[model samples]
Structure formats: C-alpha cells, structure tokens
Target: MSANARTVHPLGERLGKVLPPLMVLGVVVAVWWAVVVKTESAIFPTPWQVVTGAMELVEDGTLWEHIRASLFRVGAGFGLAVLVGIPLGLWMGWVGAAYRTFNPIFQMLRPISPIAWIPVAILWFGVGEVSPIFLIFISSVFPLIVQTTSGVHTIDRRYLRAAANFGVPRSVLFRQVVIPAVLPEIIVGMRIGIGVAWLVVVAAEMIALRSGLGYLIMDSRNAGNRYDLVIAAMIIIGTIGLMLDGITRLLEKLKTVRWRYVR
Candidate 1:
C-alpha cells in the first residue's frame, strides 16, 4: 500500500470518532442561536453572549474562586465518604446482622433527596462550609455503601471456599480476595458518588454559601439578571462533573478491574 493510503485509514478512524459529536454540537448551537434570534427576547442570551459572560468571569478571577471553592468541597466530602463508606459497607456485607440493622435506615435516608437536607444542614452547620460539605457527604455515602455491599454479596462463593481451604487467615482473605473482588464495584460507586457530590454541592452552595458555582448562578441572576453568566456557571458545573466522573472511570482500565468494565 502507498504511504498516503496507510495514513488515510487511521486519520479516517480519528475523524469518524470525532466528527459526529462535533456535528451534533454544531446543530444544537445553531438551533439555540436561531431560537434566540427568532424570539428577539433580550432575556435569553445567544451563545456568543454566554461566551462573553464566561470571559468576563475569567478576567475578574471570580470564575477561578468559585471553581476552587466548589472543587475543594467536592473533594473533601467525597474523599471522606470513600474512607467511611467502604469499610462500613464491607463490614455490613460480611455480617448479616449489621446489614439487617442498618439497611432499613440506609434505605429510608437514601430516598430522601439531598436538597431536602439543606434546611437541616443549615440548621446543624450554621451557614458555613461545613453545611455544604456535610450535604455532599450525605448525598454520596449511601451509593458507595450500597454498591460495595452488593459487590461483596455477589462475590463467587468458590473464591471464598478456596481461600479458606488454603488456610488463608480472615485478614488475608479479606485483603487479598474480598477487596480485589469488590474494588471494581467500589470504583463504580466512587464514580456515582462523585457525581452526586458534585450535584449536591451546587445545590448546597446555592443555599448555604456565598461562593461556588451554584452561588455564582443564583447571584448573577438575582443581582443583575445576568442570564449569560447563569448559563456559564451551569456549563462549568456540568463540565467539572463530567471530568470527575471520567477520572473515576479510568479506574476501570486497571488490569485487575478491567473485566468489570469490558463489554
């Protein structure tokens, strides 16, 4: 084959991967711009207006401040949830009595929307970073626990039997077998938990804090009717959430856990 022909296939493959999404996004933006123009509504911003608004925030350093605050809250809360949830879930999964005792409360609380806890969070933490952090933690922890528990329950019985037959100590069995078996589920839960944490933090920040992307959206609209900035904040929030999920999804690439993610 000619060198040009060889190069064309890989280049075509790359374009095939990228072109469809770009076309869809272009269509959406075109539609959005057309709607704004046809309506002639001053309130709804054009895509360019939103871009300019984002630029303004970027120049003023407000965007970074809000992003930093939001990221810190998510990281802290989600990190804490992972630390507590995994061990608790493992114990509960291993012990039927613990599972029975706590499962009811988990189910009860899990169904309650994280936003519903805002007032209680405010009352308990008194309008500080703690309130939002607490809210994010609450939103994230349950999923981790539930997924981890399910991972443990679904583990192959033969693996455990073999471990026992080999005279593996309880600690070694858990360290070597149980943890490895459940790590995939735990990573999945982490991806879910981080998304929830990102979602809850925005809501919490809107209600409980003076800073963060949620507050930026609310404050921009309420203070100056800045719909462009409101949309910009939303875009930033969504982009960051997607990035966090992507980071956790990378865990699935690990050789030990790749089977869980492979189609």
Candidate 2:
C-alpha cells in the first residue's frame, strides 16, 4: 500500500479502537442512569449525582485521604508479596525436590479465600494494618508462586546446556540465563498478583480498617443514607484498579516487546 493509504488506514484503525470503548462507557452510564431514574430514590443516586458527590469529596479532602489509605494498603501488601513470592517461586522452580515437597502446602492455602481468612488474620495480626496486609499477601502469593515456578520449569534446556558448556557458574547461570529467560513469566505473575492484591485490599479495608475508600462506603451506609458517596467510592476504586492494571500491562509490553520475533 502507498504511504498515504497507510496513514489513512491508521486513522481508521485508531478511530475503530477508540469508538468502541467510548461507546461501551456511554452505554454503561446510560444504563446506570436509567436504573437510578426508574428507582427514583435518593437512596439510589444517578451517575451524575455520584460524579458530583465524588467532586464534593475531592474538594473537602476526604477523597484524597481515603485514596491514600487504600494505596498504602495496596503498596504494603504488594511489596510483601513480591519480596517473598518471587524468591520462593524461583527457588521452587529451579529445584525439583523442593518443588515436590513444598507445593502441597501452597496448594492447600491457594484454595482458601481471603475473606474466609479475615477472622484468622485479625486474630494473628490484630485489627491493625497488619491484618489487612496479611489478607493481601494471602490473595497475591499463589499466582506469583505458581507462575514463577512454571516459567522457570519452561526454560529451554538448550539455553541451560549452552550456559553450562561455557563453564558458567551456577549462580551466574541463574542470574544471566534463567532469570532473563523467565522474566516474561515473572512479569505475568506480577500482573496477576497485582490484580489479586487490589481485590483483597478493598475487602481488607472494609473488614479491618477505619480509613480508605472501603471504610468510607461502610461509614456512609451507617450515616443514615449517603448512597451517593457509596457509589462514588465504588467508582473510584474501580478506576484505580483499571489504572493499575494498565500500568502493569504497559510495563509488560515494554519488557517483552523485543522478544516478539523470537521463535
């Protein structure tokens, strides 16, 4: 195709991509507005009402405070999960016997819901940030552990053999060959773990905490009827989650785009 045709094609493609998401968002808002109208109750505020409530919260500094609290929990939980999960996963992946011996425990824990562990988490860590952090950790650990091990196990044998033939030390081989080869997997695990971390953070906040958006929602419910604030908080939580996922996806693309042509 000619350069002019290629340029036109890109414009069409970009519009095609942009229009769908915009239309979907529009449809969702319309449905939400319709439901609120049909209900015709202040207890079920419309989308515009929620947006105005969100702005009011923003002006009063309440939104920022809640956002900070939620973000702190996410960071704490995600940091802990990454620090512990990645190393353990790498170890399990690189060693066969270790994988066999320890995987069963992980399997048992993996099926346990974060919400189910709320009572235990509170008992063990108390009703503080630690309890919520523990919940986040539980939610996030399995994906990293499973994915990292899978990635490590899937490394091409020829890569290992080539490294060994060069008399590369075991430590060096892991650092140079194995880590790089499995990085795409590690990033994938991080993506999944980050998602789970976000999911658990909201639940933890609602159950164990006095601040954050989750608490704001519960607090609104208790204050005689602020469904507007409740809906606003939910929107904020969803928006932040979407932003987090997008960031991780962009990071993954940046890390792995160069490997696209590899067979």
Candidate 1 residue lDDT tens string, 81-129: 9999999999998889999999999989998999999999888889999
What is the overall TM-score of model 1 with all chains considered together?
Answer: 0.94
- Worst 10-residue lDDT window for candidate 2 reads 254-263
Worst 10 residues of 1 by lDDT: 4-13
Over the stretch 86-149, how does candidate 2's per-residue lDDT look in tens digits? 8999999999999999999999989888889999998898988888888888888889999889
TM-score of each: 0.94, 0.92
Off by over 4 Å in 2: 1-3, 8-14, 255-257, 260-263
lDDT of each: 0.92, 0.86
Output the TM-score of candidate 2. 0.92
Count the clashes in each prediction: 0, 0
For residue 221, give model 1's deviation from the true position in Å: 0.5
